[model samples]
Target: MSVTASQVHGAVQTLTQSSDTLFLLLGAIMVFLMHAGFAFLEVGTVRHKNQVNALVKILADFGISALAYFFIGYWVAYGANFFADAQTLSQGNGYELVKFFFLLTFAAAIPAIVSGGIAERARFYPVLIATFFTVGLVYPVFEGMIWNGNFGLQAWFESQFGYGFHDFAGSVVVHGVGGWIALVAVLFLGMRKGRIRAGKHTNFAPSNIPFLALGAWILCVGWFGFNVMSAQTLNGISGLVAMNSLMAMVGGIVAALIAGKNDPGFIHNGPLAGLVAVCAGSDLMHPIGALITGAIAGALFVYLFTYLQNRTKIDDVLGVWPLHGVCGAWGGVAAGIFGQTALGGLGGVSITVQLLGTITGIAVALIGALIVYGIIDKMSGLRLSEEDEFNGADLAIHKISSTSED
Candidate 1:
C-alpha cells in the first residue's frame, strides 16, 4: 500500500522538472504581457489619431521578431537551433522551447522600444524590415557575446579584472542596447512634421493619462517576473530579487514625483525607470542600494527626456535614451559598485570591469544601429511622407482609427 523510496525520488524529480518548466513558462507569459504594456504605453503617449497604429506596430513587430529570432537570431546567440525532429526538440520536456519563448520576449522588446521613439512618423514596412535585421543579426551578436560567453570577452574581463562582467538579468543586453538603437532610429527619422514650427519646438502631451498609467502598472507588475524569473529554476529562485525590484520601483516613483514636480506622466513612468535600472544588480544589491539606484534612474529619465526634447531637438517621445539607455548602462556599472563587499552586497564585481562591459555594449549598439538605420534611411527610407505625417499613422498606415464615434 506504500510507495517505494525509488518511486518517491522519481516523483520528486518529475515534479522539479514540471515546476521549472512552469516557472519559465509563467515568466515568458509575464514578459509577453509586458508587450501589452509596451503597446498601451505608446498608445497613451501618442496622439489619439496614432493610437491604433501604435497597437498594430507592437503586435506586428512581435510577430516579425519571433520569426527572425526563431529561424536565425536564436542560433546566432546560443548556437542552438531547432532544426531537429519533433521528438529531438521535445527533449528536456521542451523546457528549452519555453526558454526560447522567454528570451524571445526580450528580443522583441528592442523594436517595441524603438516604436515609442518613432511613433506617428515611421514608415510601417521599412521599420518591420529594420526590426528583422536588428533582432536577427544586431541584437544576437551582443547577446551571444555577453550572455553566452561566445567571444571570450567575459573570460578576458576575468583575466584582466578580478571578476567577470555580470549583468545578472540584462540591463545592458536588452534595455541599454535597445535604447541606443532607438535613439539612432529617432535621429535618422528626424522630428515629426512641424515638431519645430515657427523656430520653436512644440510640446505635445499624452492624450490618455489613464491608459498611460495602466501601461506603467502592467509593466511594473510584470517586471518582477522579468527580473525574478531570470533565475529560471526553482532552486535558483531568490526572494531578494523580488524585494529589490519592489524597492527600486517605488524609489523611481518617488524620485520622479520630486524631479518631475508631480507630473502625471513622469509619475507613471517613474517605476519603469527604476525597474530598468535595477535589472542588472537586483540579485546582489541591498534593498536600499536598489532604491538609490532607482532614484538616480528616475531623475535621469526626467532630466534627459526634457533635454532631448528641448536642447537636442531629438523627438524621442518615450525618452528611452534616458530611461533605458543611460540608466541601463548605469545599472551595469552600479552592479559593480553596489555588488562590492564594502557596500554590503554579495561582492565579486569591479567598477572597472563593469565600465568596460557597459562601454562595449554601448559601442556595439550604437554602431549596429547606425549601420542598420543609416542603410535603411538611405535605401527604403525610414519615415513617412509629409502628407502621411499630417494625416496620422493610424489612417495613413493601418487605415483605421481608435474611435467609432467619429
Candidate 2:
C-alpha cells in the first residue's frame, strides 16, 4: 500500500497539535508550581508569627483565582469559554483548554503578587474577594486589550504609531497589572501594626533565608517555561527567547549583588527582577540589550525597595511595587527600545506604542483596583483589628503558628 500525500499532511497536523497541547500542559504545570514559590517566598519574608498565614493566603488566593478565571476571566479576555459539551471542547487535542489552563496560571498570579504586598495584616476573606474581582474582571480586561487585541486598541495603536504594543510574555499585562494593583491594596491596608515608629519605618528581617532563596530558585527555573512556552505552539519557539532570558537573569543577579551589597534577600530576588523586566522583549532583544535591561531593573529594584521601605509611608511588604510594577513597566518600554534594529533587536516596535500601552495597563489596574478594593474595604473591612494584628496573622487568623513545641 502507498501512503497518500493528503494522509501524510493530516498526520503531520495531528502530531503538531498533540505536541503543542502537551507543550502547553507542561508549561501550565510549571507556572502552577511557581505559586508554591510565591507561598514559600512569603513564608520566608513575613515574621515567623505570620508564616502560616502567608502560606494559607497564597494557596487560597490560587484557588479563588482558578475559579474566577476558568468561569469568567478566560471568556472576558478571549471571548471564549468552556460552556460547550466536553466532547466538543476536547477537539484540536484540547489545545484551547490547555491554553486556558496556561493563561489561568498567569491570571492567578495577580493575587499571588498582591499576597506578598498585603501579607500578615489583611483579612483573609476580603482578600479572596478582591482576588475574584481582579482575576475575573480587572485583569482580563487589560489582558484582552493587549494580548487579544480587544476593543480595537491595538489596531488604533498600530495605525497611529506604526506598531502595536508587544509584550511577548506579559511584563505589563501580568506583572505590571498585578504589581500596580498590589500597590493599591498595600496602601489601602496600611503598614503592619507597629512597623512604623516616630515617623520612621522599622525593618523586618526575613524569617528564613534558605526558604527565601529556595523560592527564588523555583521561580527562576520555572520562568523559562513561563517565557518560552508563551509561544503557545512548537512552531513558534525561539532560541533567542531562551538566550535573552538567560542573559537577563544573570545580569539582574550581578547588578543586584553590586547594588544590594551582598544582601541575601536581594541576591535571590535579583534574577526575578531581571526576568520580570526581560519578559516583554524576550523574543526580540539581543542578549546584550536584555542584559542591560535586566541590570537596570535589578538596580532599580534595590533602590526603590529601600526608598519605599524607609523614606515613604507606603509599606509594600516584599516590595511588590518595585519588583513587579516598576520593573514590569520598564520591561514594556525596554521592549520598544531594545526591540528596535538599531539596538540589535528584531525591529518591529515603537517606543510611543509601548509607553501608551504601559500607561493604559497601569491605568486599568489602578482604577479597577481602587474601585474593587475600596468597595471591599468599606463593606467588609480589609484588615485585621489591631489586636489580631498584634497577635500575628498565623495565630490570629489561622489559630496556629508555623510550628509548635511538641
Candidate 3:
C-alpha cells in the first residue's frame, strides 16, 4: 500500500475535480427548480380557469428550452472557442456543457415571463413555437457576445474602453431578455377581457393570493442558486455571493413592506424584487450595498407595476416587467456604484460603462423581442380568438376545464 508521489498528486487532483463537479451539478438542480416557482407564480396570478394552460405552457417551455440548449443555444451562448476556429469545433464540449446548463436556466426563464404576458389568452402551440425561436436562436446570440469571451461583446468593450462589462448573474441576459419578450408578447396578445372599456379599468384580482405567496417564497429560495451559481466556479466567493443574495432579498422585503400601503401585491413581490436587483452584482457588492440595491428594486417594482397597469394598460399578469426587467436594470446599475474592488477586487469598469451596458442590453433585448413577436404575429396570429379568450385558454385550446372531476 505504498503510494508513489505522482499517484498521490493524481489522487488529489481527481478529488478536487470531483468536488467541483458535484457543486456545479447541485447548483444546476437548484436552478432547475426555479421553473417550479415560475409555474406556480403564473398559475396563481391568473384565474383558475387557466391553470392547466399555464402548467402545460411552463412544462413545454422547459422541455423545448432543454432540447434547444442541447442542440444550439448552448453553443451559441458559450461555445465561443468552438466557432473561433471551425476546424477545432469539436474541442469545446467541456466548456459547452457548463454553458448549456447555465443558459438553459435562462431560456426557461424567458418563456416563463411570456406566460405571464399572454396568460389566459394564448394559443399553446404558437406560444411554444415562439419560445423555441427566442431561447434557441435569439437570446444566445446576444448572451454569447457578452459572456463567452472569444465572440462576446465584452471583448469589444474591453478593446474600446480598457474594461469589459460585467454581469455576475444575468440581470440583462436572463431577466431583461425575459422581460422584453413578455412585453412584446403582451402587445401581440392585446389586453385581457374587460381590461379596458371606454378608457375605464376592470376588476381583476389574483386568483390565489396564497398560491402567489407560496410561489414567491419558493422563488426567493431558488434565487440563491440563480445568483450564486452564476459564478460558474465555486470558492470562498460563493459564500459571499450567497450572502449578497440573501441580504438583497431582505432589503427588497423591507422596502416592499414599507411601501405596501395595504396593497397585497407589493407584499408578495418584494422578495422577488430584491432577488432580481441583486442578480447583476451579487458577487461584487457588500452585504449592506446589496440591502440598499434590493430595497430600491422593491420600491421601484411597486411603482413600476402600478404605472404599467394604470397608465400604460399593459396587463402584466404577474408583474414580470417590474420584478425582472426593472429590478434587473437596477441590479446592473448598482454593480457600477457598489462594485468595490477592495472587497472582491473584481470589476474595474466605470459606472458609465455599466450604465451603457445595461441600457444597451435592455434596448437590444426589447427590439429583438419586438421584431420576433411582430413576425410571429403576422404569420400565425398570436392571440386566441375572442371566443376562446373568453372561455379561457385551458378550455379552448386543451379542451379541458380546471374544475373537471378526476
Candidate 4:
C-alpha cells in the first residue's frame, strides 16, 4: 500500500503523543501514593489516641478531594481557557486522562495539610466539609489560574512582567496552599487539650517516633514523582528535576542533623523540608544549587518547628506549618535566588519574576485559606467540645479505636 506524505506525518505524531501520555500516567500513579505516605507520617507524629482518627481522616480527605477535583476543581484549574495563546486544549485521549490525574493528586495533597492541624480532636464530618471546600473551590481556583494559563496570577505575571512565573512542580501550588489552610485551621480549632494553660506552652511529644520516621521515608520516595513529573518532558528536564530533588533531600537531611544536634524530629522533618524547598525550581536548578536550597530549608524547618511549639501555643500536631508553609515559602524564594541564568533556565529568566511568583503565591494561599477556614469555623464549628476532645476523636466520632474494639 502506498502511504501519502500527510499520512506518514500523522502516524509519527500519533506515536510521539502516545509515548508522552504513557509517561504522564505513570507519574500520576506515583504522585497518588504520596497520600498514603502523608497518612502514615501524620498518624506517626500524633498520640495513639488520635492514630485511628488521623488515618481515617486522611482516607476520607483523599476520597472527598478526588471527587471534588474531578467534578469542579479540575475544570476550573485546567479546562481550556477562552482567552489564551495556547487557547486550545491539547488533542488526545491521553491529554484528558493525564490532566485529570495530575489535578487529582494535587487535590489529595491540600487536605492532607489540614490533617495535621485538627489532628487529635476534630469531628470527622467537619473535617470532611473543610476538605471539600479547600480542594473543590479554593485550591482549584488558584492552581487553575496559575497553571492553566488563564484568568489568575500566572496570566497576570506574564502580561505585567514579560515572563511567566514558573513552578516546575507544586512547592507553592500544593504545599503552600495546604500549609496556609492548615494554619488557619489550627487558629480556628484552638490548641489541643493541655497544650496551652495560663499562656504557657506544654510538651506533646510524638507517641511513636518510628511511625514518624517511616512516614517521612514514604514521602521522600513519593517526592520523586511529585517533582520530576511536573517537568512535563520525560527525557531531558525530567532527569534534571529528579537529580536536583535527590540532592536537595540529602542536603536537607545533613543540615537538619547539624542544626538539631542529632534530634529525631529534625532528621524526620529534614527530608520533607528539602523536598518542599527544591520543588519550586527543581527544573531550573543544578544539583549544587539544590543542595544549598535543601540544606537551608531543612535548617529553617528545625527552627520554625521549635519556635512554633515553644514560643506559641499553636498545636500543629505534625508541624505542618513548618514543613509545608515555612519551608514552601523558603523554597519558592530560593528558587528565585538559585535558579539563576547560569543554572538551567531554558533561557535566562530574571530574579524579579521568580520573587514576584513566590510572593504572589504566598499571599493568595494565606488570604484564601483564612477566609475559608473562618467561614467553616463559624458555620460547622471547627473544634469538638472539650469532653469529646479528651475522649479521643476515634471513640467520640467513630465509636471504635485503632484496635477496632468498643
Best by lDDT: 2
Off by over 4 Å in 2: none
Residue 119 error, candidate 1, Å: 0.7
RMSD of 2: 0.8
Q: Give TM per candidate.
A: 0.98, 0.99, 0.92, 0.92
lDDT scores of the candidates, listed in order: 0.91, 0.94, 0.78, 0.80
Q: Which residue pairs collide, candidate 4? A: 77-144
Q: Across residues 221-316, which tens digit of lDDT does each residue of candidate 2 receive?
A: 889989999999999999999999999999999999999999999998899999999999999999999999999999999999999988988998
| lDDT at 13, model 3 | 73
Candidate 1: deviation at residue 25, Å?
0.4
Top of the candidates by TM-score: 2
Score candidate 1 by lDDT: 0.91
In the range 121-199, model 3's lDDT, one tens digit per residue, is 8887778888887887778776876676646467777787777777878887788767877877887777888888788
RMSD over all Cα atoms, model 1: 1.3
Off by over 4 Å in 3: 80-99, 150-152, 341-347
Taking the tens digit of each residue's C-alpha lDDT, what string does model 4 give over 1-406? 8999999999988887777687777778888888888888888878777888888888889889987887777767776322323324456645656857866887789888879776886778877887887888888876876677767566567678776776778888789778877888887887888987787888677888888888888889988988887755455446788889999999899999999899897898898999998998888887899999999989988888889889886778778888888788778777777787666544344467777766776777778778777887778787888998898887788787776555
Error of 2 at 4 (Å): 1.9
